[model samples]
Target: MSADYPSMTTAEIRSKFLNFFEERGLKLYPSSSLVPDDPSLLLANAGMNQFKEYYQGKKTMKEIGAISCQKCVRTNDIDCIGEDGRHLSFFEMLGDFSFGGVSKQQACTWAFELITKEFKLPLDRLYFTVFTEDDETHDVWRSLGVAEDHISRLGEDDNFWAAGPTGPCGPCSEIYFDMGEEVGCGSPDCKPGCDCDRFLEFWNLVFTQYDRQEDGSMPELPHRNLDTGMGLERMAAIMQHKTANYDGDLMQHLIKLGEEISGKTYDADDYSGASRSLRIIADHSRAVDFMISDGILPGNEGREYVLRRLLRRAVFHGRLLGIEGAFLTKFIDEVNAQMGEAYPELLKNVALVKGIVASEEERFSTTLDNGRVYLDEALDALADGAVLSGDVAFKLHDTFGFPIDLTVEIAGAAGHDVDMDGFTACMEDQKARARANAKGDAWGSFNDVWVELSDKVAATEFDGYDNDVIEGAKVVALVCNGESVDSAAAGEDVEVVLDRTPFYAEMGGQQGDAGELSAEGVALTVSDTKNHNGLYAHVAHVAEGTLTVGATVTAALNAERRGFLRRNHTATHLLDAALKQVLGEHVSQAGSLVTPEHLRFDFTHFEALSSEQLKAVEDLVNQQIFASKPVVTRVMGIDEAKAAGAVALFGEKYGDVVRVVSV
Candidate 1:
C-alpha cells in the first residue's frame, strides 16, 4: 500500500501537516525555545509546554486553534536511543491545538484525512485506540468509517492523559499503523496497543474536558480543548517505506556524515557494535547542536549537564568508531546546513555551536586517555568473567567524567562484568553527602521558606547597579531562625526582604554585597545577600534596635568593598580570556569565585599547566590590566549578545535580556 505513495522527506511531511491544518483555519506558530519557561521542566519535552498556561486557564489565547512543528528534547529514553529504530533524544513534534474551537470529531477527521489522503497511507493498515471509558471518542472513530475491529479500547495507562497528579485531565485517542505480520511478534491478540514494533503509534489526539480537583473529583471544564501531536520523523519513516526513523532523509544525512568521518560503512543489521556507534553519533550530534543553538551549554548541572552528557556520549561513540581528534564539529556543521532552513537559529549559532563542541571534545579526549589507564588497571586485576567493583567505576565517572555505560561496554567486551549495583550505591552515597552538606548551610535549608515568602512578597527591585545607597526602602518580610517572624530584636540574626535594595545578591560566581540597613531606632548589619527567585533576602542581624516588617529602612552598600569586588570580577574575565589565548580555544571556564580579596577561576584543561605557560598567561592578564582597556557594559537581548560574540558562561542561566560586559 505504501508503494503507491511517493516517498517524502521529513521536511516535506512537516510542511504537509502544517499546511493541512493551516488551510483548515488553524493559525501557525513557531516552535518555542528548548529551554522551557516552566520551572518544573528541564527541557521542552512536549509541544503543549508553550500552551500549558492556556490549558490551565492561567492565560488566554488569541487564536482559537494553532498548529506548529515544535522541537522537543526528551532524555528519559537516553539509554534506549540508538539501540532502537524509533527512539530519539531530539525530534520534531507536529501538533495542532484547539481552545474550545475544534471538537473531537473534527480532530479525528482531520487527522484521518491528513494521514490517509494527504500522506497516502493505506486506510486498511491503520488502527485506532481510545480509553476504555471514552465512548464518545470510540463512536467518533467508528463514524469516521474505521472498522470496529481496527479500534481497540485501552486502559487508563495507555489512553488516559494527565498534565500531572492533579490538573487538566482527559482521555486520548491514538492512531497506529501496522507494518505487516512478518515484522511483529507472532500472537493472535497482537493489536493497536501491543508492545511490538509492528504497531507504530504515530499520533495522539487528546480531548481535555475535565479539571481534576485535589480531592480526586474530575469536573467537566467549561470549555473543552483539543491537543494532538504527531511525530514528524515517525510519519516520514512510514511514508518513505523505511523501518527505522534513522533511515529517513533527515537522520540518514547525519549518519552518512558519521560514516565519512569514521571511514566506516553503517550496517543496518549490526546493532551491537560499529553500526550502533554510528547511530548514536548521528542522534547525539543533532541533539547537541539543537541544545547549544537554544542557548544551553555543556556544564555540570541541570539542562547544561544534560547537554554535556549528550555531547560527551557522541564523542565517545566517535572513539568507538575509531575516529580520532575532534570530529563532532563536522557533524555540527552538517546539522546546521541541513536543518538551518527549518530552524534558522541553528545557522546563526553555528560558530558558537562549533566552538563549544570543539572545547568539550578536547577536554573529553584528555579525560578519556586518563580514564583508560585506570580502567586498564582494574580490568587487569579481574579474572575472566569476574566483576569489577562499582567503586572503581564511580571513580572513573566522578574524577574523569567517564560514563558508566561506556565502562560496562568496555568491560563486557573484555569478558568481564561490572558491579552495576555497587556503582549505584556509590552514586547514592555521594548524593546523601551532598544533601547533608546542603542541610548544614543557612541558605540551602531555607529554600522552602523562601519559596513561601516569594509567594507573599513581590520581587525585589534592584537599585544597586548605579547607586550605592537606596533610601526609604520598606521591609516587606522577615525571617528569624528559619521561621517567618514579624520582627527581630537586638543581636538576633534574621533574613530581611525589602521592596527595594541597593545590595547586590550573590550570583554568577560573585560574592554578595555587604551592606547596612538602617531606620529610626534601628541598626541592622547585613552580612550577605542572596536571591531566591528574584526575591533578594538580606542575611543580617540586629546590632542595636528592633527591626520589623513594614519599617522604612535605608539600604547602604559598602562602597570600598564593592570597588575591590568589581576589580576582582573584571580580573577574572581577563584571566578567562588570557587562559583561552594561551591554552587554545578548547579552554572553557568550569567554575569560578569572585570576592573582594582575590578571584579563583576554574577551567577545563588537559593537564597541569607548565610554569612557563602559567607565566605567559599571567603576563597576558597583566598586560590587559596595564593597557587600561575600557570596560564597557551593554544591555541587549541574549540573541544580540550571542551575535556580538559575547562569551556566556556554562551553568549560568540567562534571561531574554542580558547584561554583556566587554573589555
Candidate 2:
C-alpha cells in the first residue's frame, strides 16, 4: 500500500465493485440468505451458489448479467479461523457474473481496469496464475500487456474450478499481490505460487466455459459464463497496508471492543493466547449474528448444528479472553451497528438475535464446566506427544456439547495431538447410523440421474389453488428409486411424474396432497407429492391397473382432504399473523408442517410460549375463522407480494410470480 493512496473501508470497497459493474450494464442483486434452498449444500458457500440452478439449466437467469456482495459462510476451514490471517467463517464476496452475456476478453479487461485504475494499486506488484493447459487465459493476459514472468501456469488442483462431482466447471485465473520478502518463507523461490504470505491472492476469475461430466470429461457449456469473486475484507486489508486481516478497518473496531471487554491488549507478548481468542470471538460473532437473523437456530443436526458449533466455539473463546458469562450477546448490537447499513436484516432481527445468543450463552456455561472436567481427565491420561483417541473426543462432543477445536486446543497445550482421522471416522459412523434410522424415503441423493432428470424435465405446473380436477394430464416419466421406468404394474410402488396436475406438492411446510389418478385402464393411489428440485414427483402405488407413459389421466385430488388442507394452510397464515401481533415482530417462522390431521409451526422465540399467550394466539386464529374472511389469492411478482406486506416464509424459495395467500 502507498501512503499516497486514500483509505477505503469495507463498505466503500463493496460499493466500488457494485458501482463498477452497474456502470457496465450489470444489474445489482441483493445478497441471498446464508441458508440455501439446495439440499446438497449446508450453507451458501460461494457467490455463485444462488446461480447454480441457472448454470445447470434447471432455472433460467432473470438477468443476462448481475453483480452482488453475497454473504457466505464456509466452515471447511473453521479450525483455521484464528490461526490464519486470511480465512473467515463468514465473509462478503464481491462478485460480478455473466450469464452467457459477456466474453472473456471483456471480463478480464474490466477486472484489470478496476484493480489498476480504480483502486490505484501498483501494477508491478500483481501476478496472474492460470490453468496449465488454458492457453486462452494466457493469451488474454498477454493481450492485456502482462509480462510473461509475472504469470504462472498451475495444475488442476490450483487453477481449475468445479462446484461438485459434476456441473459447470472450467479453468480459473487468480490475481495475487506480492507483499515484501519480510513475509516470505526465505526459500529464495518466493513468487506468486509460493505458500508464503509474500503473495496475497485477492481475486479469482472463473471462466465457466465447460461442464464436468460424471465420467470425468470436460465438455463445453451451453454458454460461456464469467464468475468472479473478490474478498471484500482482503481488499480492505491490502489498501490499509495490513498483513493481518484483523487489523483491517472492517474488523479493527470489533477487535478494539473485545480488548475493552477483556481488559487485555491484542498483540501483547504476555497475552498471545488471549489475543488469538479475541480475534476468534470477533470473527465468530459476525457469523453467529448473520446466521440467527436468517432464522437458523442452535440444534443437533444439519445447518442448525453448524450454527450451534459456531456459537459454542465463540462462547469457549470468550472464556479464554477472561470475560465470563453471556459476553457474546453484547457483540450482537456491535455487529448490527457496524454492518446494518449494508444488511438491514441484521437490524431487523437484532432483538431476536440477542435473545437467542444470550440464552445459548447461559445454557453453555454449565456444559463448558462439565466438559472441562472430562477434557482434563483425558489430558491427564495422555503423556507428552501422545494422541487422544477420536472416540473419546467424539464422546466429549456428543455428550457434553464440546467442540473438536477446543479439544484440539487443550490437548495441544498438554503437548499431545488429536487423532483427527479417528475423529472423522467416528463422526462418519454416527452420521451413517442416523441416516439408517431416518424415516421415509424423503432423503434423496444428488447423483447423475437426479441432475439429468432435472435438466430434461420442465417445471411441474400447479393448479391446486384453483382447480380440483386435472383433466388431460400426461404421465411424463416414472421412477422406482434411482431407476427410470416406462411403466409400472399393479402393487408396484413408484414415483409418478405428471405433465400438469392440480395437486399441491409439499412446500412451505404444507404436506403433499393425497388423491387418485385414473385413465382408461390405469389407476394409481397417490400417497404423497413432493417438489423434488423443480420436478413434482407423485409418490404412489399402482392399485388397480398398470400405469404407463404417455397416458392421459384425470388427476382428481381428494376433495374432502383438500378442504382440510386448505383450512390448515389458511390457519397457518392466521396463526403467523397472530403470533407476530402477540409475540412481537421477533416472531418469524422457522419451520412448518400442514396436513389434514394437524399443523405444526416452529418459530424463533427465546422461550416457550406461556399458557395465556398460546390461548391468545389460538383465540385470534379462531376469531379470524369465525369472522368468515374470504381467502384471497393474488398472482403477482415476489417483489409486489412483499411490498403488499405478505409474510414470506423463512426457508421457502419463491419464483418471479408468486401466489400470495391472504385472509
Candidate 3:
C-alpha cells in the first residue's frame, strides 16, 4: 500500500528519493503510523515525531528499513497564519531515516547531493545552516565538498531544535530552497532567522547524536541517526510554481470546493471570513481525516479537544463559507479517496469519524445563537476599550472554551480592539492573588530587627516505629523571642532547641510530627517543627519553667500524626510501583503529595488517567493497603537505592544516606 502513495503527483518526487537512496544501498521503509504518547507533546509535531522514543533512548529502533509520510502539527504561530502567504496549520512530511549502520559521511553527503543533483536544484540556490559550535556537522558538510561560502553557521537557539527543558536535542542543519529575488529582499538584515520567507525550508536533517537529560545535561546516544523531513506540500508548491501553499495541488481542490460552498472567490488580500473559511476548510478537512485515521476520537482536553476545536473553528468558518449540514464530514471521502493508501485509517474509520464529527457538529449548531450573544458581550467589554478583565476572560475560556482568537475575530468584525494587555495584567493579578491567599501571603514580612532568631538545636529522629519517648539530650542552643539570650525570659519563653527528641522531620512528602519536651516536670510545648541542613529544628515554648541549654528532658511526639504519615508515605511507594506495572517503562515520578487523607502521585503518563487505568491504579494501591504491607524506611547509600530502583524526582540531589522507603 505504501508503494502506491496518496498524492501520487508528489510521488514524482518520491521516485527521485527511492532511486537516490537505493543507489547508496540504504533500505527504504514506510513511515510509522503510531502517535507518540509523551504527555508534554500534544501530537506528533514533526516527521521525526514518532521516533522520539528511540531518539530519546526510551526505545530502540528495531526496524531495518523506514520511509514515512508523517503528519505533523505546529500550533505556536496559529495566530499569524490566514494572513501570511505561506503558513499552513497541518502538514505531512515526507521523510527517510537511516538507523546508522551505514557511513555517517555518506548519509550527510548523499542528502545534500541528492537534492542538488537528483532533484535538479540549482547549487547556488541552496543554503546550509549549521550549528555554530557543531564541529561534527561542519566537518561533514565540508567533507561533502560543499563550498564554504554556501554554508552558514548559526548559534544553538536558531539552528539547534530542543524539544523542551530536556530530551533528545542536538544540532540540526536545514536545507532551504531559495525563492529568488522576486520574494522581496532577504529580511532587513538579510540574516538567518530574520523572519523572512525567501528561504523556503525544504528539509531538516537532525543528526540525533546526544540525548539531553532532565538536569540540563547531555548523554551520548548509542546510535547516531540520520533523520530528514521534507515539506511535501511545500515542495509541490515550489515545483509547480505557485506563491501560496494552499494554491498548490491537493488544497487547490479543497479551496475551489470551499469557494463553491461560500459562493465567493477568495480574495488573497483580505482577512475576511471568506478567505479564512477557505483556508479553514482546506486545512481542517485534512486534519480531521488524519486524526480520525489515527484513532483519535473527539472528547475533551488533549487530542479530543484539538479535534473538537478544529471542527468548531471550521464550522465557524462555514458560517463564513456559507456551507451547512455537517460540511466537515462530507469532505472525508474526498480525503479518503485521495490520501487513503498511505494512511488507510481514513477509509477504514470513515463511518466512525463521520459519526463523531456529525454528532458534535449538530450539537454545536445551536451555539451560533450563543456565540452571537458572547460576541455582543465581548464587544460591550471592548466599548470601554481600556482593558479586558481577567475574571471575564476566564469566564469565557472556562464556560465555552472560547479562545482569545475567536474573541479577537469577533472584535475585528465590530471595528473594536481587544484590551489584550489589560486582560493579561488582570489575569496575572488574579492568579497571584489566588496563590498568595492559598500560601498564607496574608502573613506580612516584618521590617528588619523585629524578630531575632537563634541557632536551632537539632531534634532527634523518631526512627519511625520505635520507643515514642526518649531521655532528652543536652540542649545545644536556646533563644528568647527574637533575641539569642542565654536564658528564657520570665514570661512565655520561646526557644528553638536541639535536644534528642523523637519528633519526626517533615520530609519525603510527609509533614513533621509535633510533641512536647519537659524537664523536672516543667512542660514545654513543641509549637512547630521544621528541618534545615539535615537537622530537625524543634520550635518550643516553655509552659511552666524557664528553658536553658544543657537541660535534660523527656521528649515526646504525636503518635496519631506519625501513624497517618507512615501509612500515606508507604502508600506512595506502592503507587509508584503500580504505575510502572500498568504504564510503559517510560513512566517516572514527576512530583507527589502525601497526607493522612490520601497520596496524590504525579507521573509521566501522557493522557489523563483513563477511567480503566485509573481504576486499575486505585485498585492496585488499595490492594497494597489491604495487604497491610509493613512500611520499611531506611537510610542507605544513594547508589544503593538507585541500583535498588528507587524513584528519584528531578532537581533533587541526594546525600550519601538517602531515605529509601518501601512498602
Candidate 4:
C-alpha cells in the first residue's frame, strides 16, 4: 500500500510473470484445454497436469524448462467462493517447470527476484515457509539474505505436495504476503500458515524429487524436477492493493455487468447477502464462459455437471439480487472482451457460449421456480434441528433437476442439515437399478464369463484393419451357455476368441464385423464380434464338428458387410463436419451409431434444423463425397494429432498414440 510500489492490472501481472520466466530461458508453453486428457482428473486442476508425462518418465523432456499460464478449475471450494476473499472456481496458474534441468536453488532464487524486483513487492512484508524436513530449501532461502525469523518451517501436511496418493511428490516451499495486523487474528502465534486473511499464500514451489511407489515407499527420482504455481488472481489482488480477489481488475468488469443487470452495488468490505451474491455471479460467469469455450456443456454428470453447477449457482445468485429472465448470457460478451486477448478461444466461441448459457438459463428459470416450491415445502415440514431426508432430496433432483449442492445450501441457510450419507445411498441405489435395467441379466452373466476368461487369455490380436482372412489362428478361449468351456460341440451356441484374427470388433459407435470361423474339421457361423477390454469375442454357433480351445482355424471376415460399415462410418464423420458448418461450432457429437445399413448421429443443438438448413448439410456432405478426396489414415502421438486439428470427443480417454483419419 505504498506509492513506491506500482499498481498493475491483472493482464500486466500475467504478462510480466511470463516475460520474466521467458527471459530466464524457459520455453513458453500454451495452456492445455480445461477438459483434461488425463483420466484420473475430473478437470485440469493445476499447472503441472499437462507436464505429468514429463515428471512420470513416460514422455522424455524436450526442453530445459517451460513456462505457462494454465487455466484451472477447482470446485471443492465452490460453496465457499463468495464467502471469502480468495477462493475461486476458475483461476489462472502462472507456472514455470523444469524436468531435471533447473536446481532447487535456482528456482527459489528466481522466484524471490521476481517477487521483490520485478513485481516490486515490499521485501520486508513477504514471508516464506519450507517443509520441516527440507533442509536444502531452508538453507537456500537463508542464503538469499532473508531474516531467519521471517521464514517458518512447517510440517508435511502444510508443506508437502503430491499429484495424487502415489506418483511424483516432494516437499513444498510457500510464499505468503502479510496484509497487516488489522486483518490478523491478533494472536501472538499468527504466522504464514495461519488460516487468516492477514497472511495470504500466493505461490507454491514444489521440488519434486521422489517417486512414491504403491507399497508406500518414497524413492528419490532418477532426475529431480521443479514445478511452481503462482495464482494470477492472488497476485493481482496484492498488486492492486485490494483485499478481495473479486475486487481485482480481472473480475471487476464482470461484477460491473452484474450490477448493471440487477441494479445492485458490490461492497468490497462486506461479505454478506447482496455483496456475496454479486461476487458469486462475477466469479461463476468467468468459469461458465471458459468451460463452455472448452467444449464442456451444461449437463447432469462428470465435467458437464460441474459446468451446470457453476452456471446455475450464478443464476441462483442473480435471482437473489432480484435478476429475472435469462440474464446469465449478458456476461458472455464482457467475459470475452476481458479475457479474449489472453485466451482467444473465448472470442472464437462467443456465439456458442452465449447460445448455451441462454438456453440453460431459460431452462433453469422454470426449474428454479418449481424446485424452490418443493424445497420450501420440505423445509417447512422439517422440525428444528431435524435433518432433511435423502428421499426428498433425490426427488427434487430427479423430478425438478435441482442440484444437491443447492439443496444443501438452502437447508443450511434454514438452520437445518441434510442426510448426505442417505443421499449418497439413494443415488447409488438408483444407479444400480439403472445399470441392471440397461445391461440385463444375460449381458451381466456374459460379462462375468469374460472376466474369468481374461485371466487365462491375453488380449486378442486385431488384424481386421487390412486383412480379411487370418489363417492358422489358434482359439484361446471358448464360452457356451454363459460359461467358459474348453470345447463346444456342433449345434450349440458359443463365443470364441482366437490368438489372432481378422475380425473387427464393435467400437466407436461402429457395429462389429460379421464373419465365419472354419478349420480342417470344424465350422462356426459368426454373427457379431464384440470387444471386451481388448479381447475380441466372436459370438457364434457351432455348425459342424466340435470346436476346441487351442484349435487352429481360419477367421474370415465378411468383406462386403465391412465395406458397407466403412462407408457408413466415413459418412458419420462428414455429417459431423457438415453439421458444425451448417449449424454452429457448438454442434458437438453426443452419441452415434454406425452400421452396415445406416448410421445414427446424436449431437448437441439448441433448436431443430429447418428444411433448408438440412438441405444445406446434405448438399455439403454430397459435395465432399463427389469430390473424391483421398482419405488418409496415420498413427501419431496424441499431441501431434491435436496439432493437426483432429477432432476428439469430450470425455473420451485417448492413448498416447492415436490413429487419425484425414479426409
Using TM-score as the measure, the top candidate is 2
lDDT against the true structure, per candidate, is: 0.86, 0.84, 0.65, 0.86
lDDT value, residue 351 of candidate 3: 62
TM-score of candidate 4 versus the correct structure, residues matched by position:
0.73
**lDDT (Cα, tens digit) per residue for candidate 2, span 1-663:** 333456678888889989998998988988889987556678887788777655645444656688989999998778778776777889999998887887888889999999888987777778999999999889999999889988999998999987667767889999997777777798876787788888999999998888777899988877888899998889898887777677788687888888889898888222248777887888999999999999899988877988888898989888777886578877787898889999998998988898899888888998988998998998898777889999889999899999887888888888888999999999899879967766432112333354567667777788787798989998888998678899999999988888889988888888889998998777899999988777788889898889887888899988899789879888887888999999888888888889999999888988888999999999998899999978778899999998999888787878899888779
Residue-level lDDT for 485 in candidate 2? 90
Show model 4 residue runs off by greater than 4 Å.
1-3, 214-216, 376-394, 397-399, 403-566, 585-602, 607-663
Per-candidate RMSD, Å? 6.5, 4.6, 14.7, 8.2
lDDT of 4 by residue, 1-663 (tens): 333588999999999999999998899988998987565567898998877656755344567799999999997778798988888999999999998889999999999999999899987888999999899999999999888988999998999987567767899999998888888999999999888789899999999989877899999876898999999999998899877788799688888888898999888888888889888988899999999888788888778988988898888888779886788877888888889999987886787788888888888888988999999999999899999999889888777778787798899999899998888899889878855555222112222566556645788988778899999999998988777889999999998988988998887788988889999889999999998656799999899999998899999989999999999998988999999999988777767899988999877676678999999999999999999999999999999998999998643558899889998
Off by over 4 Å in 3: 1-8, 14-30, 56-65, 142-145, 186-192, 212-219, 267-273, 374-390, 403-406, 409-416, 422-663
Which of 1 and 3 is the better model by TM-score?
Answer: 1
* Candidates ranked by lDDT: 4, 1, 2, 3
* Model 1 lDDT, residue 438, Cα: 45
TM, every model: 0.70, 0.84, 0.59, 0.73
What order do you get sorting by TM-score, best first?
A: 2, 4, 1, 3
* Backbone N/Cα/C clashes per model: 0, 0, 6, 0
| Ten-residue stretch with the least lDDT total in model 3 | 440-449
